[model samples]
Target chain A: MNRRRHTIPTLALKELRDGIRNRWIAATIILLGTLALVLSFLGSAPSGELKVAALEVSVVSLTSLSMYLIPLIALMLAFDALVGEFENGTMLLLLTYPVRRWQIIAGKFVGHSTIMLLAILIGYGTTMAVLIFTNDGDTSGWQAYLAMMASSLLLGCAFLTVGYLISSLVRERSVATGLAVATWLLLVVFYDLGLLSALMLDEGKYISEGLFTTLMLANPADAYRLFNFTGITEVANLVGASEIKVGLAAPLLSMLLWIVVPFLLAVIRFQKREV
Target chain B: MNSTPTIELKAVSKRYDKLTVVDGIDLQINKGESFVLVGHNGAGKTTIMKLMLGLTQASSGQVLVMGENPANKSFSARRGMLGYLPESVSFYHHMTGLELLNYYASLKGVAKTEVSSCLEQVNLSASAGKRVNTYSKGMRQRLGLAQAILGKPELLFLDEPTTGLDPSLRRDFYQIISDLRAAGATVVISSHSLSEIETQADRIALIRSGKLVACGSLDALSEQAGLPVHTRLAVATGHTGRVAAQLEPHFEIQKITDHSVDLVCPVNKKISLLRQVADLGEVVLDINMNAPRLNEIYLHFMNGEKA
Candidate 1:
């Protein structure tokens, strides 16, 4: 039992080490940091009191950047987990250990999650700290700042789970890479478009409220939007009427479901695979 | 012969669809035994190793390492009982050799401090700090051996262990296998080099077309194959035709180009045959009794159903 407990953490540490050394990881971090910096300069609101506060200006700017950048970083870090190992022939070595397959998957998930969380924490963390320092401690934007971090983590966990699922489903790394990128495009971009078309075709009567509510809960990105837009004024209204009722309960449950379902499927497939 | 079987396969078989890769076969390898399995390509040698390590499941029958099924989720009890060196040994390219060994050792429940000594045993101590991707094939094969020997497993399964090794290094690897046998670890390996393995393996198991065609000690296999142990004789004069006719019924004369004639005689008939051949001609040429090489025995069985 002690050996089993150690498997997750040990494998997790290995994942962390591998992630830190990966050039893809370094490149992702730098690209996301640059995007954050660029968005800070472009996306800030001009009419608000935050105009004078460069830090609040940056935080507000990062709100849009974090949504896209965090998921992108998370996807890049995790999409190749099992498929990459399969290609490298190390998965066979890993399976020879006494650990269970689910434990291995969980360990990898945890490890990738840690790297994602740390990246978001550092990149957004630097921007937030800069905001607070430059804004003279106006701290009204602090709650939104922390909420954005939490949303980033929630979104990251969702994508990492998606990545593991892709790795499990596709044996070839090239195929896995293609499918993973397509999944990202669908979920982050096309999913909302599909939902919008469905809402329009429904004429806002039947599917608009209930289906939109379910869709918001179904797509993890929408769940992140729920958390970020719940307390805010303008963005909350623009999301749709059903999103107004999305509270801590629905989004949290949805995020938890996102983490559990795909990960559980990955573990199940990993257990049966010949490694 | 040792009594306890460190590794056992009971009517084990693996199949993919209609094709059987490893047919129903039973192999019992005792503790401290150095057993080598030899075969051609697609002869199910590596498949057996993978089944032994629980990296793959047998379509039927049981494979046990140290009396427990390797695929059991509660396999921690037997975790360090066996070490496996896969065919193409590739590790985390980012980790140094020491780190890779340390990681594997930690999983096998070895003390972290003893990792250095494990590396030393395989002569990889100096290269321990280098990344795995930087290591040559011979170096990687050494590292693979190092990892396999780390926890002092009761059984070791090596697949084509000397693939990238030179002749001297292959001798070194055999020496290491001998050392493992002396230390009471059962070593099982599969390779194509039968001549070298003839000295290394306590017993050889021959697999052809996924079936166990032959298996036994070298002498035992020779006896089973009914291969006449031959003696090469080089006589002093033109007695070639006379000696060839004299030994025709009892022995096979392979060549008589010069004064030398090579005749193969049954082990039991060699002494009398040598004397008769000597009396027929001047005994200037010496006699050398040749035990049938494993390669010959391998071809004999591989060609037909003799043994």
Candidate 2:
């Protein structure tokens, strides 16, 4: 029993080691940091006389960047996590151990969540550090910035779970990759596009305010957006949704549900998967 | 051998959707016994191993390891009692050999300190710090064996453990298996090409198309196939005719030369016939007996099944 409990940390540590050895963590940090720095510099160019604080503008731009990038990178990290093991013939050996399949899922999810979290910290943290040092704005803008970083990790967890589901459901690595990409397109890109088209078509006629909020929160990416952008005056004004009424509960809970439902399904599917 | 079986499959079968990969298989491997499962690729050897290891659930019937249903969630292979080496053994390419083995050792609840010793046992100590991607195929296989033997598992499952190994390394691999067997671990090995294992396996199960065609010790299996034990007799300068005359009544001549004759006799009768040839005294100067090979026995049964 003690050994069984120890299995997840053992496995998670190995996965983290793999990430470090392959330079995955380093590359992701550099990628995020560089992009965040670039967005901070150029994001204020189109303020159009609003003269909002630079850090607030950075939050708006970074949120948009993370909405597309975090989920995509999370999917990229996870598309091959299980299927690749099967292809490599390592899953068979791994299953012969005393660990359960759900432990494997738990361990990998924890490892990937940590990786994404680190990327967010060092990547956005650099920008945050620069903003503080430059006295770009008072510490008031730090709240939304910190919230965006936290919610970005949550969004990453949601997609990571979805990626595990895709990996567990498919047999071929190529199929997993294709399915992961297709899911990202459906959620991150097309969901918003489809929602925009509907709102334009409705023009405040058919889609009610509550329905619009539900629609936005249903997709994890939009949930992340609402969680980051809601209740922030500068960003809310920028996206032109000042009248939006939402507590911290709905989108946050929806984001967590996005993480959990697919995670549970992935565990179920992986439990029955033959190595 | 211990009376209790380390692994028992009673009419166990596994089906993947529309395909049946493992037919009803009933087998009992006694504790400390070394059993080999030999067949062509896709003939269900690996599937049977998977079933025993609880990597796959049997679609029908029962599979018990150490008297516990292996597929049950409560069954813990990590109590430091079970080990497995999969075919074409692969590792995280970015990890050093020591790192990979250490990870498995930790997963199997083995002491982390024993990792280097395990690598040394497989002659991988020198390369322990090198990444797996840089290791050769044989090196990877050695690393696999190293991890499989950690904790000195009581039951070890090896799927084609010796593939990609040279002749000397194959001999070393079997030596390690023999040592494990001597240590009272029930070992199950699966291989498609099995000639080198003739003397290593205490018993061999011949599988064909998800079915056990024949199983037993090599001598028993070949006898069941009705393969003959071949003997060659070389005579003195002028005794060939006399030796052939005496041996002709007892056996079929596979070949007859001026000075020697090859006789094909039933395995059970080979010893007696050789005694009889000795009884003939100086007529035969030399005698050579050939045991039927595993491949021959395998072909005989595979063809019989096809027919």
TM-scores vs. true structure, each candidate: 0.88, 0.90
Off by over 4 Å in 1: A1-5, A23-26, A37-43, A47-63, A231-243, B1-4, B232-263, B267-287
lDDT (Cα, tens digit) per residue for candidate 1, span A61-147? 565566566677777777788889989998877777666788778888889888877777777776666555645666555666677
Q: For each of the candidates, what fraction of the native contacts does it recover?
A: 0.41, 0.69
The top-ranked prediction according to TM-score is 2
CA lDDT, candidate 2, residue B18? 86
Clashing pairs in 2: none
Model 2 achieves a DockQ score of: 0.48
| Candidate 1 CA-lDDT value | 0.78
